[model samples]
Target: MSTISSASSSTTTASRPTARNLGPKPQDNRIPVTPAVLRGIFASSRTPLEERSISRVAFFRFTGFLLSCLGIAWAAARGRGIKNSAALLGVV
Candidate 1:
């Protein structure tokens, strides 16, 4: 039982890959950008036309920004109300 467990553990550890085992990473070429490249990058062929089937990341980011704006507005309103209440109590 002990030998079997040791063998299984060794096999599992050996099967796992190290960073050096993987080859070098690919480098991006962002130094020289022309007008054409900029247009291609911004308006690629894969650009979604329909609003309902847009990229998930873009959708989430937009939603997060909208929610943040709403939260800021709510906090500002609440803070103003608190200040008014405090001022009224102080006057009384």
Candidate 2:
């Protein structure tokens, strides 16, 4: 019983994470911008960037594509639920 407990405790301690084991904390001065967050910011009606950069323009196009996909998906799902072919094709 003692040996089993000691082994379990050692394993738990070894599995525990240290600061260096993980990436920078939220409080860190420098944090990298993720693509999802950047795209989301641009997808908003009002964007902060005045001058267009590569990332900004790319995200703009991506946002448009995503919006269109969502619209089409919504229409398709609605059509399926309501059993309306016209709505599925977005005719109405």
Candidate 3:
């Protein structure tokens, strides 16, 4: 039993030095940016003028759809007086 316990303790002590050396040691400050990475980031940052025009059209279409939906919901709720008059009815 004493020999087994000593062997296990020695193995544990041997691993501590290797575990401490396995981590980053403050000298790994290198940027790995290639041309492909730079081009990808640049292309995604700003759209071209033609693409901007298409995006503007899509934006207005989506805005109009959203406004129409909001108007329908507002008119329906106003007709029912559920959202506004519920507070007065003590159901809120």
Write the residue-wise lDDT of candidate 1 on 8-87 in tens digits.
99999999999879875565544777997886676665646632355676889999999999788668767767555455
Cα error of candidate 3 at position 28, Å: 34
> Can you give the TM-score per candidate against the true fold?
0.33, 0.31, 0.39
lDDT of 2 by residue, 22-68 (tens): 99767888657999788767667554464356568889999999999
How far residue 47's Cα lies from its native spot in candidate 3, in Å, is 9.0
Per-residue lDDT of candidate 3, residues 25-71 (tens digit): 66687668899889767768777985678779999999999999988
Segments in model 1 whose C-alpha atoms lie over 4 Å from true places: 1-54, 82-92
Q: Which 10-residue span in candidate 1 carries the lowest summed lDDT?
A: 83-92
Better of 1 and 2 by lDDT: 2
Higher-scoring candidate on lDDT, 1 or 3: 3
Higher-scoring candidate on TM-score, 1 or 2: 1
lDDT of each model, Cα atoms only? 0.74, 0.79, 0.80
- Write the candidate numbers in order of decreasing lDDT: 3, 2, 1
Stretches of candidate 3 off by over 4 Å are 1-47, 83-91
**Which pairs clash in model 1?**
none
Question: How many angstroms is residue 30 displaced in model 3 relative to the true structure, after the best TM-score fit?
Answer: 30
What's the count of clashing pairs in each model shown?
0, 0, 0
